[model samples]
Each structure stands twice: as structure tokens, then as C-alpha cells.
Target: MTIQLPTEIWWRILDYLPSNKVKQLGRVNRAFLEKARQSRYQSLVIYEYDKKTKRRLKKIRSSSLGHYVRSLTLCVQAWPASDLIRWDGQTGDSLSVVDRVRSLFDSHYLPRKTVALKKKRLDRRIELIFEAMTAFEHIQEYELIWEEYDQDCPEEFIPEVKFASSLMTIFLSMLVISPLRGTLTKLSLQIPTHIALDCLAAADFPFLEDLKVFLWKSQCSRAKDWDILTGYLGSENLAKFISGLSSTLQTLSISRLDPSINLDRDFGRVFDLLCRTNFPFLRSFDFCTRSRYLRKGTPSLDRFVRQISHSVRSLKLSHLAYDTSSSSPLHHLDHRSWISNVLSVQGLQTRAFSSLTSLRIKDGSLSAHLADLSALLTSVAHQLVSFFLEDNLLTLKEVETVVCSLSHSSSPLRYLGIEPRDLAPDTFDLLVCAFPGLRELSLSFERFTSSDDDVIPMTEEDVRCMFPNLCLDLGFFCFGLMNTAGATADGIICLRLRSAVSLEIELCLMR
Candidate 1:
């Protein structure tokens, strides 16, 4: 007798099985085949295109398997000469991609014969990508990553193909017009230059919920020299595009690797516009810049933060700080007021960020003003479940101030990560007791003493006293298992510390 399970039961059981085991069960019946199709076709990532991939995509397009795909990631890397060989002998749909590509180039008056041989090759790959994308119908998430070797590549290596900025813009414009656009909810574009942003500003993403734009250079572009990129900073286009999506967008993350653009003038304008727009559904907003000083847009930044404070659950403001040393003494006198101007709203200091639970403040000169930092932390302590202050190492006294500020909160925090300029024996006890419900803790100390061996003697006894079962491994001590189940079992504790050269400790516990 054979066991017969309901379809839902079979689905639940298959979800728990590994891919290889699921494949074995897939051959049993049509139901198993359906589950296997979903498991295999739901997410697809193609790094490079070739004869094999072309053939596989053709099969998927002609069958029902394409409909099962919900996510796709296509990495466009520097095309090797072999991958872009002319389609001289191929026929049928191969010729169609060539014709469509040639027509697109012709529209710009870029005659295929006059263009560089490598460019013509690049054109073929771009067209092939377009054709390959038509296979999926229900894609809800799509990531288009332009992967190129940087200047750090070995001198012996030579990049054969060089693509123009306009080509990328054209490709992106066409990509958004696909049939799957209406169904897309998450979109990530990793491209180079503000030209792409300008081109995509007009495209509509009615259902888009999450948008991430990462601007960097491709292999064809030179490194550290952003002067090659033409066109204005697309601030107006970006503001317009984001405003259009405000009704449905829930998460927005924007990052730029190019450091030449002035944050005060470019990003400040963007934030100034964002301050006025209302995002009823927005829950997370992350903006990162490489600027060392934020001289302008303090008022706009404060308003923007306060505008979303009530709705956003996770907030990150990275590398946004003023440089006191760069300013004259007269201007330096206003440092505390400046920090307040950027952090708090006009009349809602305590009520700001009422819904925010996760906050990350990273890489800046914020530690210079201890009082303002303490006040900001104290105000949000009761609501934040995960708070991380990275790259801003506080002194031992400053760390005590932070702990004391957060100690007033009634809610228990689950994760806390911070760095201290120095570490004392009592530091561990202070942190562990400060947040009794902390499940994970990260502490990095810049120095233990003048000598490197000072760290071992400082932490060894304290760690041993706290958890005797911690096993020593390669100068670091660890206790309990690393998995979540083991973390909850037997009230186990895991602690690891390094030497004074760079003393670091990571501890995790339950209850």
C-alpha cells in the first residue's frame, strides 16, 4: 500500500526537503513536478550568456516554466571576444536580435559597419539580453548588475570591450517597458553615472515597492576619476521619480561610490524635495554619501528625518557629519546646535522616530559632541530594538555615558554594536548588564595598552569567570554552539576576544 498525502501536506513536506531530495520526489507524479518547477524556476540569476544559456532560455520561453519565475538577476560583465563572436552563420531568432540591435543603433545614426568591432560585439550581447528577458512574465524582483574589473586588476589582463554610457541608458529605458513591469515590486539597478538615472526618471513603476540604485564605474570606465561621466547630477529627475512612487514605495536605498559630487548641493537638494513629499507607506529609508562634512541642508535633513520618523521602522543616516576642525573657532562654537539642527525637528523632539525600531549611525565625527549624541540616544532608546554605531569609536567615559543614557529606557534591546577607544575589565560586565535581553553584542577596541599582549591578560580571566566552558581556539575563546537552537539551549554563552593589537569581542546570549 502506498501513502497518499494531500497536496498541501506534500507542499509543506517538500518545502523542508533539500533540492537534491526534492528532485528525487519530483519524478513521482505531476504534483511533485509542479513543486519542483517552482523550487527551480522561482529565482534565476544568469552571470554570463553563451550558446548553452541561449538554448536553455529558448526552452524556458517556449514552455510553462517561465511563468514560475518571480525573481531574476542578470549580471552584465565585460564581454570577452569569444562570447561576442558575430552571428555570421546562425539563422532564425538569432538574426532577429541582430536586426533589432542594429535598428536601435541605427536610430542613433551609429552605423554598425562604422562602429568599432568590439562595440558591435557589445551590441549583440545587449540585444541577446533583451531577447532573453522576454521569457519571464511574472517577475516581481529584478536586479541588473553591471560587473566590470576595476583598476586594481592585474596589469597582464586587458579589457577588450569598452561600452559607452549612452548604451547603458538605452538598455535600461527599453528594459522597463517589458511586459513584466506591471508585476515588478522590487528593482535594483547597479549602473554607472547619473545618465542612467536621468534616462529612468520617465519610466513608470506603478507597483514598485523597493528601489535600490547603486552608482559606480564599469571596467570600461577609469577608476577614481569621475570627471569622465558627463551630464548634471540628475537631482531633479531623481526627486521627480521618487515622488511619483511615494504612494506605493515602502523602501528606498540610494548610494553613490563617486566622491566628486558635492553632497551639500546635490544630495541636499534631493533631500529638500523629499522633505515635502509624504510617503504614507514608506517603512525604511537609507541614504549614504562619502562626504566628510555636511555644511548645508541641516534644516532639510532634520525635516526629512522627522517626516518619516512616524512611519519608518528602520532608518540609516551614514557619513553625515560636520567637521569641526575644518571650521574656524567662531563657527565651531555652534557644533552642538548644528548636531541638534540635523537630528531633531522643530517642535517634535521627543515624539520623533516614534515607530523606528532599528537605527544605524555609521562613519562620521559624531562622537565629538557627547552631550547631543547622548540626548539623541536617550530619546530613542525605548523604541529601538537594534541600534548600531559603527566606525565612531567612543572613549571609555563616553561609552559609560551611552550605557547610562540607554539604561533609562523601559524596553529591552536585542542587538547592540559599538566600538570603544579603550576597553577596561569592567566594560564587559557593564555592557552585559546594560541590556539583559541582548542576544548579540559587538565591541571593538582600538588599543588595550602600549604593548599587544595586554589584551590577553585583560580579557582572559574575565571571560573565564563569565563562561568557563568556552574553548580556546587560535588565541580566541568561544563558548556554546553558533546556531540559534544551541544559543537557546542550556543558557549557553559565546564570547571571543583577540589580542591588544585590535581587541574585539562578540558575545551572544538568550535571556
Candidate 2:
């Protein structure tokens, strides 16, 4: 080990080099591999197969770059039963008596799991995935994607492995976590509540900081088979399942079409976990549910929001409420007000929205109304200076409340977006008049009436009179961009008014 090239300059040089060049440098020698490890083998996508994966594993294991992999994605998909026989020829001769015995034990002891294919294929795939994944020892993030829906399904199915095959991805998900426990910092996995809860309870990720779990199709699972995840798995079990990540997880996003139809208790359990667990460093919590506001659950959810309001910095919730009283698709807006009230809780006067800086609510059948919204802005305008609201702004009365309530508050809002139905010249004028200190505003006027009452337009001076410190966007205005020098509030505003009776103002807020 005599003199060599300076190691400190390698990073700077690698910055300008492409990926192929980095791989090229990694193969140069032991020194080059060690120095270029970070950029050489940064990401890897593994498909579940024997030969391809075996070859890759062999290459990475023999090379020094295998220790440098930081992110690994395992996309486990099902193969037809025909493919299962192809492995028989190879495995029949290769599998030892102990190996066969271990496979039997895996089926018996591995959480009663399933894959998307026959048990034989599922078992083989799981074994192959585990074997390949164990080679990458330095991975920090792991993602497991099941391709059940992406490929053709077996029309004739056996109940046993069909369910197990579906769960093979989850089983592999647990296995993926085991190898990376000491080094993993992020895990984005898709495991059913029943499986994940059990697997995670026993597993520990010392350095794991982020965990994203996608709650899969519970309705179909419940409808078709007596599956463990849906048939017997309840929210309490699900909560206990996720609690394993409480100490380490700082960011979480669990998205679904809406699992509450089958697992309402699971949704409740999430809030319960939040209430009981004190994750001091947890900065963001993102959750989505499709069920309407059933009784008991809303109150607990409200309480959860109240607790996390002062802690979590960013929150995004969707499809959160539904009409508990009526079964109609149309939601009576009043029911959603409670959620809004809890989220923007404060005193009577305008102030800063303390913990939350950005919030995007998408409930197709809801809005906070002009009055409650004004209160929310009055309370949070100082700190929550920016917000986007989609509402059917049809009444002047509501517009007046916004102006009267928050206009004089110390925490005047700096940014606001409102989509109103039945656009009126006077109401639009009054809305601008309300936010005297507004720096930026976006207004969309839909369902435009050609009648004289609705068609009243405002001149530039009229606009200026209404929005004192603001400039109108004036799409395709009289002059070019340079001519609009006097624009205020981020330079311009847009009045997107459309004429039509068919369009209804649908405010997609968290239901």
C-alpha cells in the first residue's frame, strides 16, 4: 500500500461523473470501490427470481460495492403455476433434506402468510427474495410492491395459497425489515393490518425514521375469503401492530381508497396510538379515510387532532367525513364543521396558527363555510399566512362575515384562494374589500349568470378601489406583461369566471 490518488477529491470528481462512470470506477480496485461507494451502488431494484437475482447477488457480494447500497425496492409478483414447475427440476436436485424441512417450517411458522401464486411458487419466491435481499447489508430504505393487480390472475383458484400468495409480498416485507434492522432508516411497506401488526410487534428497526404503509383492499378481502387480516383483525390489533414504530418513526403516510368500510376500528386505533405514543420528533402525519363520520369515531378523531395540533408541523387528511345521519351521497355540510372547528381551534380574535404551517384538506362534499373560515383565519392568519379554499361562495352574507370578522385582526392573512359559485360583482368587490392587507388572492367564479345582476364588470380603477393593495390578473389584459407595473400582492390576481348552469360548486375538503 504505497502512495495513491487523494481520497478527498473523489467525491468532487464523482459529482460530475455519470452512473456508468461511477460503476466503472467502483470496479477499478479496492481503493476506488471504498472511495466511490456512496455514488457507485446507491439504488437497486430487485425482482423475485432465482437466476437473475442469484447472478446479481453474486456480482454484488463479490464486489466491494454491495456494502454501499442505500435504497432497495423489492417488487414481488406472482408467476403462473407453469413457472413453478420450471424451478422443480433445479430445486429437486439442489434442495437438501434440511432445506426441505426448513421450507416446511417456514410455511408453518411464518405468520400464516400467503403469496399471489400457488404455495410452491410462493414459497420459492419468498426464499429467493430473502436470499437476494440478505446480500445488501447497508440499505437504509426498503419498499415492497406486490404486483397482483398488474399481471394476469389465475381464473381457477385454490383458496389456500391464493390468499397466501397475496400475502407473500407482506411476508417478504417483514423479511426485508429483518436484514436492515440495524441500518434501515425508512421503510415503505404494504402489509395487511393483521400481518404487519404481528410482524412488526416482534421486529425492531433501531435507526428507522420513516414508515409508510398502504392499507390494501380490505373490502375485497372481506367479501371473498375468511382471511386473517380482515376476518378477525380489528383496529385495536392494527394499532398495537403499528405501535412498534412509535419510538423511531418520524414521518408516516398511510393511503387507501378507504379501509374503514371493513376496518373502521383500525382507523380509530390509529388516533389511539397517536394519543398514547409521544413521538416528540414526529413532524408530519398524513392519513386518508373514505368512510363518513360515523358516531364515536369523529369525537375521538377530533380529540386526536386537538392533541397533535400543537405538535405535528404538517398534516394532510382526506375523505375524513361522511353523513352519519343520511345515507345519501350528498353530505350535509354542517356535520363537517366540527372537524374544521377542531383543526383551527383558537380564541375569539385573529392570531397565528401555532403548530401547523401548511394544510391541504380534500373532502369532496365539504367546506368550513365563510363564518367558521373567517374565525380560523382570524386565529391563524399570522402564522398560517397561506391557505387554499374551494367553496361555493354564492352569498354576500358569508362574504360580509369574512370581512367583518378577520379584516381588523392583527394576524391579517397574506395569501388566500376562494372558488365561489354564483359570482356577483358586488360580492367579489366585497371579498376583496374584506382582506384589506391581503398580499395575494386567487378567486374563481363559476356558474356565471349572463343576467345584468351577475354580469357587472369592474374597471381597473374599480378593481383597485376594491383591492387597495392588490393588482388584478386580467388574463389577456389590455397591455403586455411590462405594461402591468402597478400590480400588487405577488404582482397579479386572476378572476376565473365561467358561465354555465350545469357546473355545481363542489368543495372537495376532508369529509
Candidate 3:
């Protein structure tokens, strides 16, 4: 009297169970094992290349579970402490070239024997990672992360940048030539450097749709030396990579872009390439860069905004203003030359974001060029659906100006986010009345706090007072609160207001 169920029904039942439960069921019988493969192997993340990882890779390669793998995340740790220091110009140290790293200002903290052994171990780990990569056949999303490692010893400061460069090149080559190349649709590379970009230029993803590049702080600090280290720095490499995937790429986001030789000369080349080649499917474009000043009339930058004037639907621009006091040669350039060298939206009149519906502006607003910012706002005011402006706080007057511009839109905006200096008692009512069709609203309030209790409970009460009808939803609010006495951010409270309005209240501390 044994009951029989179809494999599909078993799979459906397995999907409802927790992952741990599914694994437990897998051990019950062969039928259950087959049904659980999808749950167990659908996504995998390898944080290290140790013996356990090696065993998992062996099992994957030996079984049919390889076909079930769709997403793979590989995090390559930074250089070891031994790799950081080198006793260069020392005779008969028995240091292998494979483990040889750039000298850390003539430091000899680690013994030569220790360096050699660690280098050998690192080589073995890298080999294991390469082997693990081959175990997946249908990987559709691959994320390669270069995790940051702390430099404990002051003497252990030098990095294996060159070795990392070569490793990335080989990794990219393996990825593009593998069976998963055609299946891959999303690729996120967390290794931020000119070398990474150069490696990217050498490969192509046939079906890639989403690409995200994050610039690490460590990498950002060394941007000035990238040209000398990598032996080349230019936007051409990035442009070439984009051109290769122009047809299939749908989303492109480059964050924390540091101004360097590669970013300075033809900073707009990457943007301009996206336009010239014409990414028909491109819908979202996000670019954030740190600059000392706005370059008013740079042709490359001007042409870029104009070229993509009609295609992008989501645009996010973050201009992190660098301290003008910093002594960069570009800062000393004459007014005219400065005007000719940087990207400026001072006279943007063509409705550059004509097709845009969602816009996010953070860190530095184009407030300095009021006329241009106003003009730009007016042009896109008619069609914007969601808008978020934060980091750079806006005055009440500026907030009113923004609302006035957006109020004219034919279609009501569904979402609005802003940080205002002072919140009047009637601010909530004013916003609710202004955007009748708004479904979600986000506001940031700054307050000085001496303790967590002072920040949390009082802020919640303040929120309740501001939007009394939304207090019930505050019960389930996920608050990211800071407990420090003098923390800048107190907490965030999410609330549901009325029938459709969703509110996100952020509590920040004033400096």
C-alpha cells in the first residue's frame, strides 16, 4: 500500500519546505534526493577555496546537480599578510617569482620561508577555484567579488596588484570560454581597477543584460597610480566593453567612480559609446563620480547627455563634490579651460532625459547652477513617475520649487523622496495634498541625540504625530537605528498611510 506521486508533485512539495528541511528529506530516499537537487544547487556561493569547498565542487562535478546550478558567486580574498611584505634586493632568500610581490618600502616583517609557503598555498587555492567554476554548466548569473582583507601590520601595506591583474584576466577568459557563457545574462564584477576594466574589454557576454561595477575604497585611493601599474588608462577600454554588449545590455551602473587619468580624459567616452552604438534595449543608466567642480562645457560630456536624450527610462546621477581646497592641477586651470574640461549641465535645454520616468539625484545636486537645474527639472517634470533626491539636503524653498516643477506632470508621480532641513507641522498634509496619486513617500528628518533611547522612542512618537493615521503600521517597521551617543543617523521607520500611501521616515542627527 505504497502511494506513488509524480516527480513534478514531489518537486512542488519540496519547494514549500525550508531549504534545511529539503536537505533532510533528500537523505530519506533516492526519489527525494532527485527532487531536492534543484533546491540545493539552484544557487551557490563559494567564499573560500578550502578543502570543504573542494569536496563540494567534486560532488557537483560527479553528479547531475551541475545542470541545476543557475547562479554562482565567487569571492576571491585579498592578498595574505606574507604577500604584502617583501625583502627585495636580499641575496639567496629562495623566494619564488610566483609569490614575488612589489616591495613594501624595503620591509622584512615576515620570514622568507613563510612567504614561500603561503604563496604556494594561495596558488593551490586559486587552482581549486578554477576547478569549482567548471562544475556549473548553466550558470546564468555570475558575481566575482574581490573581498577586502585587513592589513594588520603597518609594514604589510603593499598589495599584489599585478598578480591580481593577471588572475582577473585568466578568470575572465575562463568565464567567457565556458559552457555558461551563452547562458549568462547578469555579470557583476566587484574588482574595481583599470586592470579589471582592461580584462573586461578582452571578453564578451553574448546575452548579458545587467552589468554593475562597484569601486572599492581601497581601489579608489590607488586610481592615480593605475596608469603606471596597469601600463594604460583610458575610457577606450570601457567603451570597447560596452560596445561589445550594446545590443543585449539593458542596465548599466557604475558607482563611486574616482576621477583619474582613465576617468579624466574623455570621461564621457563610455557614455558617448553607449549612445553612438545605440543600446536599443538599454533602459536604466546610473553614473556617479567624484569631482572637484562642474566642468561647464566639456564637449564629450555635453554630447553624451544629448546622445542618450531619448532612450533611457531610469536615470540616476550622483555627483559627489570633492573639496575645492584640494590641490589638483585641474582646479588651478583658468576659468575657460575649467569650463572646457568638465561635465556641466549649466545650459542643458534639449530635454536630455526626455524619456526618463525614474530619476535619483544624490550627494551633490546641480544647485550651484540654479538656472540650469531649474530648466532641466522643468523639461522632465511632465513625465517623471518616481523621483528621489538625498544626501545633499534641500532647503524648504528648494523643496517647494521641486514640488512646483513636478506638480505640472500630466501623469501623477507614484513615488517621491526628499530630505528637507526643517519639517513644519503641516508638511505631511501639504505633501499628501500635493501628490494625490502618490503611492509612496520618503522623508528624512535630522535631530540631535544623546542616546539611542532619545533617538528611537521620541522619533517614533514624532512620526506618529506627523501622520497619526499611519501609526498602526509602525508596529512592523524595520528600523536601522544607530545606538551610538553622537551617531548621525538615528533610525528609519517604514509606515503605510491611508489606503495606498507608503511612508519611509528616516531620522538623522544634525552635525
Candidate 4:
């Protein structure tokens, strides 16, 4: 007897399988071939040949899987040997770009001479990706990454290794699609060096809704040219590109590799451009790079935030601090700039941060600026649903004040993160009592529990009894009911389910 299953059921079962396992199902039968291929091709990652990463996508170009792909990420290898005399200006050679790149892969190297491969084998890998991309359609997200390389490479990290100009020239001349793609809704790219899009500048991405860029700063060595490079990034072309996305973009995260990049002066033009555009649905923003610092009282970051403040629900200014020793013309910055800028905007006639709900302040403690932080919290407490204050700076009273505010006036804060040292046993109990509606609580316990009395009053059983759905994360063990809580975390993630929590999400039902 033969059993017939609905095609949807077959695909449903295949969805739970591992990607590699799903790929194997393509050979099981004709029914699985289509479903398995679709599942396998939904997301594709192509690691450049020069990377230490294993390459599994060499055959993707010839395959019909391109049509099924929705997410595509390419690690564009840096010209490892750009500085090498042998590799200089070879992109112009009559040799086909693919053939030229293949030669580097074929070359036998000598151990004594570390020629950054003179960017030897990188071209062919890039050539293959560009070739593969042309076949891609209906791709919803695109990412171009130039992975970081250790100092061992001949490339100088002080002045970031750049994508070779020759290769860029050729690629720009022939390259298709903007990093901000019209066909895709999400685009993320790392701008390690100053480069422009002569070919892609004109392309408008009506569908693009999210754009993340790592706007790296020019190395200190180029102090003289720093202004020029940064100014170039905020050129008319880039402004036009961002303006085009105003309608569709909902999330924007501009991170940094060089924290010192002055957002006010360097990123001013971009912010000016963004203010002119309106992102109706924009809701999440993150600038959590640990090293990023601000230079001005009303920095570009502040102005930019105000533009979308009305619509954004999640805002992360983690590691955003005043650069006391900032080299820009202005050396001393008021540390209170970040808080003051966001709060002062309420006086604006255009919009207030009416929809803001989540605020994450990593590496910042409220104790230093309790008054400023408190006032800022009060402004948005009614809308906030989650709050994370890492690097515990708030005293028990302060934490209590914030929690009490959330409990009484605004919606309950579902997520809370704090260090154990800041909250004594009694204080913790009070805080917990103040906010019983918490969905996740993160507590940092390092050396504090050395004394028996310093230990938290609650146990796995005690916590489980309070929040039945809570996922508790103990330092040593993470579980629900018993000592079931999982492995050690420099910090803990409270998993409020299963009467217990485990170290790895894979070990528990969370997976």
C-alpha cells in the first residue's frame, strides 16, 4: 500500500531539518527535490575564497537555486596583496578578470615571502560572486562584508586595508546593482575605506527598508585627509541614496569600526540629509559600538534621532559617551549631551518621541547622571516596555524609582538587566516586588557572591513560583525548577519557562 501526503505537509516536515540535511532530501524523491531546494536556497552565504572560512558555494552560480534565494551575504575579500609590486594595477590587464584571479589561486607560494598574496587569489572569488548576483532575483536582503583580517597580513590595520582601486574601478564600471538594491528590502555594507558609487549612485531602491553601514574612520595617520574622506561619504550622491529610501526604510543601524569618527562634523551632512526625509515606519535604531564617542552638544546623532524619534520604538545608545580628549576643534564635550539632546527635543514643534518604547544603555550607569537620566526616563516612561542599564551605575533607590515609575505610570517593563552588586538581597526583593510583570531579568554576579549572605535570596524554585513563565538564568547552572539553569554567563539571560533554564538555548525548548 502506498501512502500519499500533502505537498504542504512534506515541506513542513522538511523545514525543521538542518540545512545540510534538507539539501540531502533533494535526492530522496521528486516531491522533496523542489521543497528541499527551496528551503536550502532561502538564505545563501558566500565566503570569499581568501577567507579562513570554508567555501561551500562554488557551484551556486550554475544551479537554479538563485530564484529561491531571499537573503544573500557576500564577504568581498580585500586585495590581500594590493601593496605588493607584483599585484599593482593588474586589473587593467587584457586577461579576463576571472582568469587573472584564477592564476592567484593556482600560484605556489614561498613561506618566507608573505606577499599578502598581492591580493593574489581574491579577484576570481569576487568575479564569481558578481557573476552569481546577476542571476539573483526576488532577493529581499543583501549584505556585502569585508571580513577583518589579523595583523599577520601585509595590510596595515592602522590605515585600514582598502578594496583595491583597480578592482573597484573595473567592478564599478561593470558592477550591477547598488549596495542599496531596488530588488532587495535590506542592505548592509561595511565602508572600510573611502569609495564611491559612480555606477550604482543612480539606482533607487524603492523596496529597501533597512540599511546598516559601518562607517569606519580614516586612521589617525590620515589626520590631514580625514575631513576629506568623511566629507566624501556624506556627498550629494549618498544623500540622494538615503533620501530615496525615506518611504520604505524602517530600521537603520550605523555602526563604527573607528569610534573616534566625529559624527557631528563627519556625519553632519548625512544627518542634514536624513532630517529632510521622513521614515514613517522607522522603529528601531542601534549605535552600540563600544568605542563610539560624541563631540558636540547637539551632535549629528541627536539631530538624526529627532528626525525619526516620533516613529522609533527601540533606541540603543550603548557605549555612546562624551569624548573628553576629542581631537576635533572642540576638545571638551559635556558628557550629558546624549541625554540632554534627546530630552530637549520635546520643545520642538515638529515631533516628540511619542512612540519610543525600548531604551538600552550599555556601558552607562545612571548614578553619574541620575538627574538627567531620571528626567529623560520620566519623559518616555509611559511608553517604555523594556529597559536595560548595563555597567550598573544606579543605586538600589534609583533602580527602585525607575521600576516604581514603570509599575505605576507607564506599561510594565518586561525586560530588565542589572549587576548583582548594585542590588543587595533586600533591595533586589523590593525591586522584584515592584515589578512582577517582568518577562526577562538579567543579573550580573561576579565576585559578589563570595560571602554566603551576599547570595540572592531566591532560588530556582522561589523564582519559578513567582513568574510561572519566567526563564531563569543562574550563573553556574540555568534551568527552570531545580539547579537546571544552564552554564556560566559573564552575565545571565533569564529564561522564564520550563521551571528551569539551560546554558544553551539548544539544550532547552527555546531551540
Per-model TM values vs. the true structure:
0.72, 0.62, 0.71, 0.71
**On a 0 to 1 TM-score scale, where does candidate 1 land against the true structure?**
0.72
Please give the distance, in angstroms, between residue 116's alpha carbon in candidate 1 and its true position after superposition.
Answer: 8.5
Candidate 3: give the clashing pairs. 295-342
Q: Rate the local accuracy (lDDT) of all candidates.
A: 0.63, 0.54, 0.62, 0.56
Model 2: how far residue 370 lies from native, Å: 5.1
Instruction: For candidate 4, write residues 1-511 as lDDT tens digits.
Output: 3345688898779867877688788776777777887788778776534322223343454555567888887654443434332223343222445655666776643321224443453466455556556667667887766554543444353222443433444443443453325488888866554556554556577777787877544322245646545444534555667677778878878665554444455456666777787778888887644243432433555677877777899887655444424463222233544544554554343436678788876544334555555556666766677777665445456667656655553355677665543323454466557666666666653322211322333456765655554665553332222221222224333433343222111111121
lDDT, residue 179, model 1: 69
Ranking by TM-score: 1, 3, 4, 2
32-76: candidate 3 lDDT, tens digit per residue: 776788778888998755567778888988876788888998775
Tens-place lDDT digits, model 2, residues 1-511: 6356787777778888877677677667676777666775677877646566667767777875677788988764433343343443442223446655676858653333322224565566666666656777788888876544533444443342245445553564456376777888888876443333545545667677887877654323444445333543545544664566677777877665433334334455556665786666666777665555422234456556665556666666655444434564436555544335444443333333366665555553434344545666555545555456543443445546555554544545666655655334555456665566666665554333222422333456665665666644443222122222222112222344332211122222211
User: Candidate 1, residues 431-483: lDDT per residue as tens digits?
Assistant: 75677566555675444322232333433556545434333333433232223
Ranking by lDDT: 1, 3, 4, 2
Task: Give candidate 4's root-mean-square deviation (CA, Å).
Answer: 8.5
